[model samples]
Target chain A: MMSLRSFRDPVLVALSLVALWQVLHHIAGDSAITAPAPTLTHLWEMIGQARFLPHLRETGLAFLQALAIACGGGILIGVVLGGHRLTGEVAEPILVGLYSVPKITLYPVILLLFGLGMPAKVAFGALHGIIPVVLFTMNAVRNVNRTYLRTGRTMRLAPMQTAWFILIPATLPEIFTGLRIGFSLTLLGTMLGELFASQRGLGFLLMTAIELNDVKTILAIAVLISAFAVLCNAALLAVDTRLHRGAAPETSGK
Target chain B: MKKATWIRTVFLVGALGALEVACRSGAIPATMVTAPSAMVTTLVKTMQSDEIGGHIEQTLSAVAIAMALSITGGFAIGFILNWFPVLRRAFAPFLAAYYAIPHFAFYPLLIVIFGLGSTPLIVLATLFAMVAMIVATMTGLDRVPRVLLKTARIHRLSLLDEIWRVRLPAAAPHLLSGLKLAVAYSFIGVIAGEFILSTSGIGHEIAFAYDNFDNPRMYALILFVLAIVTAFNMTVYAYERRLMRRRGI
Candidate 1:
């Protein structure tokens, strides 16, 4: 008998997918969309290769640099806008309108400005991630309980002290969510840059595989990117959960 | 209309004026920064020739089909999950993590299957939009008050009646937000696919301009796309606001 706790539906789903892959492989008879077994084996081979680390490092470094900019700059802008009543009211709708525009369209402009290099990739990633961070930060800062501000004032806290002690703590939970989403978007933007016109990175590798019609390599790269994204997201989510533990539970809405 | 609006207008104008000055003065290189004046003329000329119009129509149609497919598909999936606790439990972890995985990575796989053109574009957009909708629909449905559900049962309402009357209306706001996201995601996904694979569409045109280093045309096209997206967002936001007011939310 199967143990109840150990019985994950995903395991069954994964097995079924593998079975489906085998069936498709037999039916299609050596075309594109290679079977899972070969793809898995190829993935291992690719991972063992020397070129993998450089591409991974390039992607990783660009993402980190961009994420850093987005978080710091986004939070600062968010705080200012959220702290000021008139400024927030005046700017919020315009920001929202701008946010609706796909960041990918600006990729061309970025390439033109920064050229085919790490700077372009970083800018693109930062641009993609920054908007969500600012929006979330603005909302979080705006929603900080008034009583806390009152208490800070009662204690005669300085403006910086009030922001540091009262505002940041209260807003941490929502801002964490923003950072998580922002990081995901940054990764996406960097990959898009790499795919579109970069000489290096996982995206470039994927593009190369596509050009060659190398299905196994393409699948392997995709798996690598997906795994990276999932791991980063999971790590951030764990941090977010931990941060929320002692704080009053906040309602997280879209 | 308001003092704040006036201030915002002034602020925007001031920024634009500064940028214009910088561009004209060669503080920023001409190749890197197209003047707003240049962008306006380029946009008007492009519109007059109907060069941008065709691309807009293509994108709009793709988005419409994608939105329809995703919403319908998402609702079906969401309802099924709601009806089956075991399925929801089994799939929750996977579904939760799905958003982080850049769906574009699957484009290669899609290309292998569909070959190219509009089919992969629509499918990818549909997939992207559908995930957001599914999550939204599930959350919205999950939030339907237990009290109202109990009341429906107390009133001897049938399952269909309870779902149609009580559940859907209660979930409308959440669903609308999901719809908003689906629309945006669909637009983004379709454009991305077109950028990566298509022979035609605004995304393809933008890439063409970029390849040729046509700054004016590139800026104009980006602006045109931005305007369309903003219009869609504003309309959805207005509709959602009206619904919220109706529901006294």
Candidate 2:
């Protein structure tokens, strides 16, 4: 007799999870693998606390730097590859080869080359996350109407001229999509790097909390990080939507 | 042309060889960086070692299991969501936010909550990859030719039968593409998890090498990983291509 509206709400999901926790704990009692579900009051109390701000700034800076590097590198490479047919064809396979390799394996190499610092984290983030941007940008640029290019050539448009006036407008949607993924994965890479081996950043803080077994502090940091992630995601989506608002109807085909 | 292909291949080989030479000349200031032959030797030795084998097994199992579970779950959710497009419409923003957020950023929390072995890795992989799979599957279903569906109706196939035999078949390429992407995505997730959080895996080894500035070991491991991925891609491509050619897909 439950309302259909209650079927899949996040609230309902949380409730169900909590109930399952209670049931399991009641049956198996307590163990290292299981922690009794904390009441909402615990979460609220952590939210009400301070000292999580500096850690937030540390993670945010890394996230931002990583995003910038990935977006910049990916877009430049993507556009260059997309601009010329020969480069596109040659770069296509190499880029895929680079992309297909387990980037996680590159972490040690990146750290070795760049050393254990923000630069290493930034470079790792860019390498891990930039592949999607390159792929999508290449796709967007490649899909430019051949007729449009021919016409531009007939009109004596310089290569840059064509790129600025027509290609960017036509390819903005896909480029934005690529950037969005690029930024998200950049954040992921930076966090992973920090978590695995670092002296600073939100991930380092989280790891420290884990080692200390301070459940309240660990959950608080997590909540803050998740909230940051969600905010960054929303901002990226907004940028993506805004960039393509000029030409939406054309891409309804996709 | 064949000549162009050969040139590209030659250039790539030459560049890689040059990179090895640079490493050997000690021009890069990283002693761990070395020639391709050295990397090959390292890889060969590591593979022959039992500890390396165990590391590969641990990393591979996490990836394999996480991938299997995520694919099944993604496909199921995708099928259902596509069946009811209203759900997608209602939750597209939430979906965007979910995928947008660095799910890895939450891994530390997961490690805290789940106390990592494989559970957190699996959850993160499934969560990260399923969104793409579901979106792909839904898009595939959304593209089913209206005329074809009408024609099937005219032929009096049951609704359920049409879905099982026709719609699913029509969406096969997209679903497979989703699976292809999920392959890399899930592997990325598990590797990241193992690297950051676990003590026994390729990731852990990679992290150790990075910390120690063992550049040669790191490059060898990268080559080893790249080989595994290439093998996986070739197999999937061959299978998918053969399947497509058979079905006229």
RMSD of each: 3.5, 4.7
Best by DockQ: 1
Give the Å error, residue B230, model 1. Answer: 1.1
List candidate 1 stretches off by more than 4 Å. Answer: A1-7, A10-29, A148-169, A242-254, B24-26, B50-54, B145-157
The C-alpha stretches of model 2 lying farther than 4 A from their native spots are A1-54, A149-165, A238-254, B1-7, B30-32, B99-120, B212-215, B242-249
**Residue pairs with backbone overlap in model 2:** B32-B216
Q: After superposition, how far is residue A126 of candidate 2 from its true place, in Å?
A: 1.7
Clashing pairs in 1: none
**Which one wins on lDDT?**
1
Q: In angstroms, give how far residue A238 of model 1 lies from its true place.
A: 3.8
